[model samples]
Target: MIELENLSYTYGGGELLSDVSLRLQPGSFHFLTGPSGAGKTTILKLCYGALLPTTGRLSVFKQDIARLDRDQLALMRRRIGVVHQDCQFLDHMTLAENVALPLTVSGQIDTAQREDLSELLSWVGLGTRLDSHPPELSGGERQRAALARAVILSPDVVLADEPTGNVDWEMSQRLLRLLVELNKMGKTVLIATHDMSLIRAAKSQVQARVLRISQRQVQLAGADL
Candidate 1:
């Protein structure tokens, strides 16, 4: 669960977000949409504590993000999984290794976990890409791989940035299923995307609240959720 109250963020001496307030509850699903350079990514950053708000308050799991020390922030992050827009990965590492990187870095990975990881990669349709590097993957493959990495730890909250941006319609539907399944299992999920069709498709499958970012404020997108 994450909460932001009257949140504002300033970048390069200009305000990117202003007077935004939203709360993500447990087992809730949300989609954040906005035009280019409209601070969608900035809001996601604030959610994950990547950037602190220049004004107002943000709390992650009830702990004031601004008050958390480095260790506290690290611990909180482990509970919140994020799939970045760029689908960032270590190009030098194989795709499977990249997907498994989270647990590996957390010192929680083992042979048993690797078995489950293989299943996860397979679930994301990346079983064959295990030995391939990030640079060798197609756009859709990279997106799925990033998603696998994001949820490998089964975090309490999942934040996906432009999750369906690179994938085709069918693949996008598949990815949406994965996120929906996670939400069904009681994990809070937030996604930032510009895909209105995707949001429209999601309307019937789940009770997702579509939140649109317009004019630097967060407003519940009308009727489309």
Candidate 2:
């Protein structure tokens, strides 16, 4: 559903990424692994149309992102859910509100689907914390809440950057399970993480291809783990 053709991005005499090309097919799951400053996050941003490439083309859901206007890009993103390494939430809103913000922003609200939101929160183990503020929750709880929010709109593709960066091993595994389940249900999943152990854990549960950002490009990662 996402394709990058000879994509390259440069800034202030530095090349964050170059000659990167890949295709993320529908229902495919991928783990992006790289060291710090290796452009893992940059790639995720490109996939979701956050930053336009300095050269080459990026297509999502068959639309060329390079030619889209701001409004068009915003509409395009509605089909792709993104989870950042640092969760973004309104400090004043309750966890439930935060999770439902996507629906609000999309100008979509079905009173009958209120139960769907509750069920999502419950799936992420945040049902009891629905009324809790962002600051009141633990790091893992916040991460799970972010995941719930990203998928609330039922995006066709999901992109997560460092999703388990702050969670414990058990929590990481739990989060992985949720992601795998999403893939099973036919959503495309792409995650950028530096944690090899987490990759290994996921490899055991699902058929996930690994991609690595190296030498200023993204390529299919070799079986090094």
Candidate 3:
């Protein structure tokens, strides 16, 4: 679980986020919704320890982020998965290799894991693209492939930014279903998206708390999504 208490961030001589506090409990599902440039992604970064808060405190699994060393931070990240708006993969590598990058980095990639890699890709509907390079995939395919990569490690927390931004409605629902399934399996999930329809759909199927970022602050979504 992740907790942020009175978190504030400043950039370029201006405040981007202020007095933000929230807690993500175990097996909780959260949707972070905000307009463009409202710091939705910044909150995600803070949740996963990508950026240290300029003020206030952030703790991951009960450990204060400011107190963790580099190695400790790395170890903490192994329990969290992040999917960015723009998926980045080495053009030289196949889709499977890109999805398995986390395992390789954590030194958990072995022969059996390699087999699980295939099953994971199939779950994301990318089985046929395992050997395909990044440039060869369509936008939706790339997004699905990114989702596969994010959860392949079976991290306790999944932080996604605009995960369905590029996909059509059908594909969006497909991706959402996978996420809901993960939450049911006891993984804490947090997704940052601007699409209210997506948030509404998720609310119908899962007990997801919608948080809206507005006026440089974060709060539970009110009469919005």
Candidate 4:
């Protein structure tokens, strides 16, 4: 779980986020929406310990992020999976190797884990693409593969930033369903996106709290959403 208390983040002498408070509970689903440059990505970074609050407090799993040392922060990050907006991958690595990077880095990769890796890729509809490289994948394939990579470690929380930004409506819905499935499995989910239609589509399938960023603050969206 992640909690932010009266948090503010300043960059380049400007305050991008101010007085934002949020608590991500276990098994919860949330959608963060706002226009471009609204600090949606900034908030996700704070939640996963990628960036510390410039003022106020941020805690991941009950420990203040500002107080954690490097090693501790690294260990804490393993509990939070993130799907970046860019869907970055090593061009030289195979899909299976890319998805298994987390396990490899954490010293958890082995024969049994490789079998599980195949299952994970299969879950993302990439079972047959394991031998392919990043350049060989289509847009939707890359997004789904990114999701697979993010959850490969079985993180307690999953944060995705504009996950469907590059895909078509059908593929977007597919990714949404995959995320919904993860929520059903009891993983905490927070997705930052500008797509209102996607958020609307998710509401019927799952109970999701829509949080909108406006004027440097975060507030729960009303029924209009």
Best candidate, lDDT? 4
Which segments of candidate 2 are over 4 A away from where they belong?
223-225
- In candidate 2 the C-alpha lDDT for residue 116 amounts to 80
Candidate with top TM-score is 4
For residues 45-104, could you state the per-residue lDDT of candidate 2 as single tens digits? 988888889999899999999889999999888888899888999999988889998888
Give lDDT tens digits, candidate 1, residues 85-155.
68999999988789988888789877776667778999888876788999998888888898889888889
Task: List per-prediction Cα lDDT, in the order shown.
Answer: 0.89, 0.90, 0.90, 0.93
lDDT of 4 by residue, 1-225 (tens): 789999999999999999999999999999999999999999999988888899999989999999999999999989888999789999999999999988888998888776787889999899899889999999999999999999988899999999999999999999999999999999999999999999989978899999999999999998633
The list of candidate 4 runs beyond 4 A from truth reads 223-225
RMSD (Å) per prediction: 1.2, 1.4, 1.4, 1.2
Report how far residue 157 has shifted in candidate 1, in Å: 0.8
What would the TM-scores of all predictions be?
0.96, 0.96, 0.96, 0.97
Candidate 2: worst 10 consecutive residues by lDDT?
216-225
- Clash count for each candidate, listed in order shown: 0, 0, 0, 0
RMSD of 2: 1.4
**Cα-based lDDT at residue 135, candidate 1:** 97
